[model samples]
Target chain A: MRTFSAVYCEWFKLDEKRYLDEVKRSANSHSPFIYPTMELLNENLDNFINHQEETVISFSQLTQYLVMKLAHENELKVLLDGQGADELLVGYDYMTGYYLNQQLRSLNLKSFFEELLTVIKRKNVEGLQLLSYHFSPNFLRKKILYRNKKYLSNRLNNIISQDNFYLSPMYKSKSLTTALIVNVDYKLEKLLR
Target chain B: MTFGIETRVPFLDFRLVVYLLSLPDEYKYKKGTTKRILRDALNEYLPELVKQRKDKIGFASPDFKLLKELDEKHWS
Candidate 1:
C-alpha cells in the first residue's frame, strides 16, 4: 500500500539537489498507480470535467478527485476526509489576521502583540505590513475583492462595485470566530456537496 | 464523495463543531498556530512531528510545474 509519504516528499527537504534526485529515483521506481499522477490527470481530464457537475475552483479539488478514484481502485469502501477542520478550527493562514483583528478590537493588546510576534517570526514578514489588514477587516476584504477583480466576470465586477452591495453578515466582524462562521456558511456548503 | 466510496467527515460532527465554536477564538488559533486545541488534545496520541507540523498540505499536490502544464493544456 503506497501511503501519502511514499507518493509525495516533504515540503522543504534540507538538501535541494539531493531531494530532486531522490524524487526522480522514486518516480522511476514506483511508476505509480496509473502512470505519473499529473499525466493521469491529463489523460482523465475529459472524464474528470464530465464527472463534475459544478465549477472547479482549485487544482487541489482535482487532486482530491484523483485520490478518491485511486482509493476506489484500491477497494477502499470508505474514506475519512478532514474537510471541516479548517473552518471549525480557524486553520487557514489568513485567519491569523482575523484573530489579530479580534484581539486588537477587544482591547486585548497583550494577546495581539504576542500573536503578532509569533506570526512575524514564523512567516518572516514585517509586522507593520500586516497592521492595515489586521486593524481593518472591511478594508482588507475590499482590498482582496479588488485584487481578485481580474478573475471575476464583468457582471460580477459590476455587482460588487455597487456601493450598496450586500456582503455577508460577517463582513463587519473582525473576529476569527465570525470569519469561521462565514466560511462554514458559504465555503463549506459547496465542499459538502 | 465519488467512485462508489462514501466520505465521512468526523470534524463536522454537530456536537464537536458546536463545542469548538463556543470556545474563545484564541483557543482555536493562538501564537501563530491554527488548530491549537486539536494539536494539544491529541498531543499524547499523535506523533510529535505530526502535532508540530506547521504546513497544511491537505492532499494538494506540490508539483507546481505539473499543475502549470495542466492549466495551460486545459485552457489552451
Candidate 2:
C-alpha cells in the first residue's frame, strides 16, 4: 500500500516534472480554478515560478538569514540551501562514493569521509540512503537488507530489487526480508491484489 | 509573504582550489581521481546498511500491478 501510493505519487510527480520541463514552468501549471483557495494557490505557484527567474542569491540577505538561524529555535528547522554550492558538492549517488573508495583506494579515507559527511548533512533522506550504502560495501552481496531493516524496508527494498543487483539469498538472507515485512506489515502486491 | 536572499560559495574560492591542488596526489586524488578525500571524511556518519550497495537502483512505485487486477475485477 505504501509502495503503491509512492508509485502512484511518483508517476504523477514525474509526469509533472516532464510537463514542467516541456513548459519551462513551475508547479501548478497555468490552471485557473473557481475556488478562492485555488486562486491563492495559483498565485503562490506564480511566486515560485517567478522566483526561478532570479536564480542568484546575493550575500547581503544570506548573512541575515544565517544570523537569524544562528540566534533562534535551536536552529532545528534551519534549511541549509546555498547558491551554486553544487560546484563543491557532488550530490551524486552513494554507489559513486562506494565505487570511488573502491576504485580510489589510495586516497586518505579519513579526509574523504569528511567531504561525504558535509554533503550528507546538507541534503535530504535520499542523501542519507546513499550515505548508508557508502558505509557498507560488502553488504550488497545479498538481496536481503542488513539488520534492523528500517529504511531498506520491503517497499523500498522491493523498489530497488527491480534492479539486477545479482544478490544472492545468502549473506543477509530472506530473514532480513521477513523481518522487514513483520515490522512494517507492507509489501508490494501482485497486480491481482 | 516576506522573502530574503543571500549567497556565498566558499567552494568556489580560488584560494581553496590552489590549496587543494597543493596537496599531494596521495591526499588529493589517491587513486588518481577527484573527490578522493570525501570517503574518509564521511566514513563515520555513513550508514552501515548502505555499505552493501553494490548496484544502482531506480525507484518504481508500489504494486500498481494491483491496479491492473482492480480494473479487471471492478472497472473492466
Candidate 2's docking class is incorrect
lDDT of 1 by residue, A1-193 (tens): 2322224333423212333344445544322332235566787777778888665544556666776777777777876777788878876665676677777888999987998888877772322333454445665646643343345467766665663234344444566677677767666565575
**Candidate 2 chain A lowest-lDDT run of ten:** A1-10
Q: Which digits, one per residue and each the tens of the lDDT, describe model 2 over residues B1-76?
A: 1233222345435565445434443442322133445545655643433322222223222223333444465555
Return the lDDT, model 1, position A105: 80
Q: What tens-digit string does per-residue lDDT give for candidate 1 at B8-57?
A: 88888778877888898768877767798998887765555456766453
What TM-score does candidate 2 get on C-alpha atoms?
0.26
Error of 2 at B48 (Å): 3.3
Query: lDDT (0-100) at residue A88 of candidate 1?
Result: 86
List, residue by residue over A1-193, the lDDT tens digit for candidate 2: 0000011233333212232232222222332211112223233444454643542112222223323323232323232333222222222233224323432254657755664554455443343443344455665523223333242357655555543243322212222222222222211121001
Clashing pairs in 1: none
**lDDT (Cα atoms) of all candidates against the true structure:** 0.62, 0.33
The clash numbers for all candidates, in the given order, read 0, 30
